[model samples]
Target: MKKTFQYVDYLWDEAKAAELGDDQVALFLYRSNILGADLRITNYGGGNTSCKTIEKDPLTNEEVEVMWVKGSGGDIGTLTRKGIAGLYTERLRNLKNVYGGLEDEDRMVGLFNHCIYDLDSKAPSIDTPLHGLLPFKHIDHLHPDALIAVAAAKDSEQVTKEIWGDTMGWVPWQRPGFDLGLQLEKCLNENPGIRGIVLGSHGLFTWGDTSYECYVNSLEVIEMASEYIEKKIKENGEVFGGQKIEALPAEERKEKAAELMPLLRGLASSENQMIGHFTDSDTVLQYINSNDLERLAPMGTSCPDHFLRTKIQPLILTLDPSDEVIDTEATLKKLEPSFEQYREEYLQYYENHKHANSPAMRDPNPVIIIYPGVGMFSFAKNKQTTRVASEFYVNAINVMRGAEAISEYTSLPRQEAFDIEYWLLEEAKLQRMPAEKPLSRKVAIVTGAAGGIGKAIADKLVAEGANVVLTDISQENLEEALATYKRDEAAIALCDVTKEESIEKAYKEANLAFGGVDIVVHSAGLAISKSLPDTTLKDWELLQNVLVKGQFLMAQKGVEIMRKQGLGGDIVNIASKNGLVSGPNNVGYGTAKAAQQHMTRLLAAELGGDHIRVNTVNPDGVIVGSKIWEGDWAEGRAKAHGIKVEDLPAHYAKRNLLNEIILPEDIANGVFACVGILEKSTGNTINVDGGMANAFVR
Candidate 1:
């Protein structure tokens, strides 16, 4: 008989499974992908899945039981065969004799090396023994919100029996270790014929004789729990004790979030700079707008992963967005002390629960901040980490809603949460992470980023580990250009530099996407080759708006953000050699270029006290991949030189000392040199025009 689900999708495709030809490991990978595809089932990089299969040993040439499980830090949704570690089940089980007790369970992690059946396997996880020691051929340990909702209920043990009856067993809260594996084994032995079990204040475990059966069982249990929770919630007829305050108007909400993100990011990054993510997502708004936000947020997250990513508790601000007008100054004043108190409390938390072997307390700042009328902001070391941290908190909110509707919600015990946070194994894992890149924790904003020089600069910045906001006047161009970069380290926002509102929207997007900009590159401009007589006021004004005024506005906004963040920044202007070596028919265009270069010097002089650097990169003839040269400008320039438009590149190259052509990539290199390499030099020009003597600045 086929089964249908209301809460979770029935994603098991038998025909697709048939394509695998019954290799247990291949089947395990397929099932793992399906389960992980839904956040309702498991969060990113959370949970564990394994299959114990009969395989032939290379040495013995005989059958042996081998366990293949998800390696540490692997996301099952994107897991490949290489991401799963293989171990000999007999070796895992043999460790039981040497295992001292719960106190010595962490040592077994080191012993996992001797059990390696696949020498090329990925690093093993703490849950390896939980899978290997179980009698079932296939096992799934998932953090489904519906199951966690029940597991995190105040009366979870009684609630588990009532919801699942005698079929699903229950074990009280215990950290993942060899000891918990034994407890699970004991539960299954005590209750014969049960299909699964729920770990209190944790997650769920369901197993089957076959991979397909295990997948189906997991779905059945989760969907059934969802249905029951929905019914009880309907009976209760209220959520989060009803809404405490109305959500601000949608547009107002975004503006409010934009205003708050940079300030909060500045406060949170006192110990180490951070990248931030903002969400007024339906789930987040629903939770924060409720009366229970203050009550429940302090209870902390139920899932260990959520708690670890979002921290033990979130910092909830008293700002009410529904007020007719908000006092920004008052909020700023409150934030200073709120941050101080949060750090002190976090330190106290560590001091209270830490053991002698615990690693030093990490950054005591809050990872999540909640505002009543606005939304949530989560900060971390990079863009992806911030995004994933926010998603984990959303999952926690879902668990809270479900648990509270049916019964009182429960968080992990304080000592247990602290133990998991300060675990020696976790410290080792953190120590194993690769060193950060030169531009790590920095965010850059690139105007004219759709194509040409702007895109090149954005790409280089991202390569050096900076998060980027790709801003351009054309939306269609921005989307097409952004798609090519193909990484989460970059974002796109449509912007018209001539307009202050457009520029504000771009900065808002940048602030929300990856905290605020630390580097600003002004690459958005156009060129015209009209002679002095041919240049009309309209032509003159167009150049000024895009070239001169655009930089003015962009710089104005960048300074505001950088000042608020209190982090020194960089502003690189992509000027032209025309600014220096003025010639025929260049009156309007050359004046604007000169203004741009001078503006760089003025800003550098003014901003130097704040440690902000301003520099310029001058390129004379960047014709290839150059949109500016594709039109009347190229025709006009070629006409002046008495050469065909096609000959412009060589014509300009011959004029330079190096006799070399300049590309957008050369301009991009200059920008990197200013921000990444020439750290001490500012108010200076780096000419990238193949050594143009006439354009050189002493």
Candidate 2:
């Protein structure tokens, strides 16, 4: 509720705005950033801003008034001019006349398209009409947590009058569309002196002649609501104190989350369709552990805006409060009946509310799941949607807490929620999303992902729309690699593949992250170059453990999870060309890799019945960006070849028929091609050695 606006920053933004040819667009971006930077004001992609401005048309060569509203697909925090859609006001106003007799969203969308001022501008937000109908020059609409707390209260109108006095107007719940926009306009006209309006069971709206004035109006209103909620909490302290809530210790929570997340994910998934889970944050725990969770959690979302993201009601797991440890087997047994009951209730709710022309019902699977001893698990078709739903639900819990502290929380009636959920405008948002990539909805795990070829493979998988869990012995390196991706789908697990417990934990993390593993890249290995006579027993054993034993454990763990889910999977092992053809002074490393190559074929034979494919990539002399080929190992290999360390790469490349140096990415490309693109060819070795005549698999 604290105001974040600074006069100096505002002045600086204004000074920079004059330099951009489109001042209105620049100012809109600036104000939107200020609003988005504060989560208490608005969450990711949850709010919008607009400005009415004059621009010269390219064809007409005359100035026309336009409403530049936030576009549909981008976040406001980093909004650019391209993120705002430009619509000709004169043409947009004409929609009111035609739209009165229309209820079809597709036709309304066509009408909206016809009013665009610029053909290349992005699609305007669905709420564009609400902004266009208002007469103000600047407008801001947001779903602030504090304001939502007030809006969802049972006596919201009374609270609005008390906190906002005559400056605010209240409108009852109406699905966002042509009619709703008209209703908002009517409210403003009737209350000529009101500074803003509260959309009951929805959000807040404020406007002024300038962007700063509108921004200030939003802050002041939200602060007022916060103060009211705080006062209520103080007065009703005794009433709130009666609720019994207990939190598990941090270590216990972590242990329980690992066991429960995978079971929840597997239960939520079906053939060719999977849902992932994330339990890293404390927000979910704080809400799920509350004693009042059962009474308040079943109440619908804080606003209709969240219906498309989070379904009407979250699925609550039945767990005994006193049980300190989660028995995964027993929990799954109990969940079977509860899941069936939840599905029945969900379908009945849909049948009770469906109209003749309603769109097809979405899957009945739960979007949010509450785990008693651990935390909450959010499930979605992919990683990004899962994260977004998690964020919204967390904010909803905060709003619920505030509302309950003052009065009982209330959302729109169930029928109204159904209407919003089926509204064509809302449904279009999902239908218009870009087509999925080839590996979309797939999950991959890459061992030795801290650097070199393993890191490159992880990057390639993510680019193809696969959620990846990068595992390595070095936690620091894993974190640094994870930071570069900037995606919620990419996670890191510090794992030593030689240890059974470590390998199991990594796969569990992957399951929790992306439901189940479909692709496994066994790229963790160590290179120890030494002559057969000089290699001691300890050195040879170390190489064998890391390369041969480590790969076996990693592959076994991945296959077990895949088999449980009953989904066909892919496993690609990274082996060296020396495994096929012996090279001087490469005894320990070469022998271990040879064992790994044979093991790949054996595993392939065993798992083929389950439709699981196993393959290997033999990459030779891949020196560039390879951490394994650094320091003493590189110098020793070069010395054995009678060449300087700097000249070793050229020496190896010149010996190959293609006469090209192999890089880490070349190996990564081979791995991806073997497991991802080649789908039919398994138990085969793909040689990525720049045409090594002797190392060929024949």
Candidate 3:
């Protein structure tokens, strides 16, 4: 029987992190899941996960020692303490620096001798030796699609040099057990104080002092690789159109999908799920039926990391697999010789290129194969594996198809691939490390940043080390926002959000000033109280333009810039608490604000594939440094309620369970949380409104 896997829904928003008992754990899981799905870093059971904690043990009655890594075979999506096998630091370190040469099997057995497995079901993760080599408190490792795409290429070494430069140390892939650990030891020693490591033909390794830090760094580094590959693919690809596979009837498609699953399962092992991604995307469909697919079949993957799922080559689909044209019987006939030929070629290549210590030989069944007009297949041991394989294949197919229009889609030669495949030192180094903030290389653009929530979010992002572009409709307010921060880390942009032309001009100026924009903060909004009956068309329009249209335009233009640069950015919309929960008699204002939250989700859904994260922050009647605090609005509300504005602050503060007043910093903190200042969050509206809506924000 064939089994199918579907995408899992996990929280990846900043505000949502507050709900988790341990934010760092939540962050790690979110990042690990993304990387797992990405196809560059991890495929099936290829990577490992770990986190460090300073906890008091009941038996010892003191703080306990060491980190806990996810036990082997546990999915990254729902990892828990039981899934983590605790490994003492001293034991792991001792295993890494062992000087004597030993057989690969001996080393593997020796490494496992240290692990004291608690549960009968739990086995220590395969990358235990690699984990012991990193110095960070928390770490994550994955064979990300983009990183693998580059690493698995024939000219991977040269490609890595051109793409990553000296920032990340690249190690050639070695067999995944003990020897790889030794290789990482040498690379880490050479690149003192390096943040992360990229394993050629393998995946990526990143770390930070905290889980959030490590997770964000993983996102950042892989994103860099993804961006590089996307550009190269775009520049070099030709638009070889594909056929419409989705047009097949549901029953027929399902049966076809079922038939293909066993072949994929045979290659991936029965433990894995062979996910089917029959896309409506023109590019994918077109590539499935392209006339050039046969010629390009031997071209292999866009990158090598996909090998875990895709293998080095895929079965090309130049004809339909329907009963009329091609049946399973005929499919088997075609695949038998092809499989034999592939095995012979692979074995000969390995025999000729073998080094002293190399990875154990596996089967030569194609991990990926084309199915004519129907689509493609990626064989993996499980759902995570299948998902990653699907992603990699789609990206590669897209790149290859696109590049076909412009140039020949050639990969690096077999010798280079063999070098990465057999490189001892490189495999040893692919361990998890702590994540860092995502804003290190980013330039953020913030509007309506004249010292309220905008200033607060900007300041927090800067503290986490992002270069901020703080903008406001008011020049004085913009100056005020600038005055509160270091001049170099932050800049000021002046523009009214209501005018599309002004919005365009401001973005252009910000880009010119900062070189590019990787994140956006829309804090510019209008606040006026009037019953729906009393509201004028002008008032409604003004509110709509500033609060709603402002964000839309910013996102639309911001996405364009981010997409072109290959740096998928984040957008934080400053909506109001009224948007989500019930509030006063202002109709236009509430509607506009509510619309902002939905817009955030829309953008996130639309641009997620492009690597952009979009979210909203709703503050409840905040009193952060603004004219509203001192002006008629505050006094009028105070008088209407028969209380002084001074007293209103205390009254509101005491309303929440925390009994804390929502400051500009609080709202700002919400914004920073969205910009990957913290590792987990998106498509959420954080309430900085003194716990106004118990039903909504926590």
Per-model CA lDDT versus the true structure:
0.90, 0.80, 0.63
Superposition error at 408 for model 2 (Å): 2.2
Between prediction 2 and prediction 3, the one with superior lDDT is 2
Each model's Cα RMSD: 1.7, 3.3, 18.7
Question: Candidate 3: misplaced stretches above 4 Å?
Answer: 1-11, 21-46, 55-64, 97-99, 102-106, 115-121, 154-164, 237-296, 299-312, 317-323, 326-367, 377-698
Model 2: lDDT equals 0.80
TM-score for each candidate, following the candidate numbering: 0.97, 0.91, 0.46
**For residues 106-140, could you state the per-residue lDDT of candidate 1 as single tens digits?**
88999998999999899999988888878898899
Evaluate residue 536 in candidate 1 and report its C-alpha lDDT on the 0 to 100 scale. 94
lDDT of 2 by residue, 585-631 (tens): 98888899999999999999999998899999999888888888877
Cα displacement (angstroms), candidate 1, residue 8, comes to: 0.8
List runs of model 1 lying over 4 Å from the truth: 322-330
Q: Specify the highest-TM-score model's number.
A: 1
TM-score of 1: 0.97
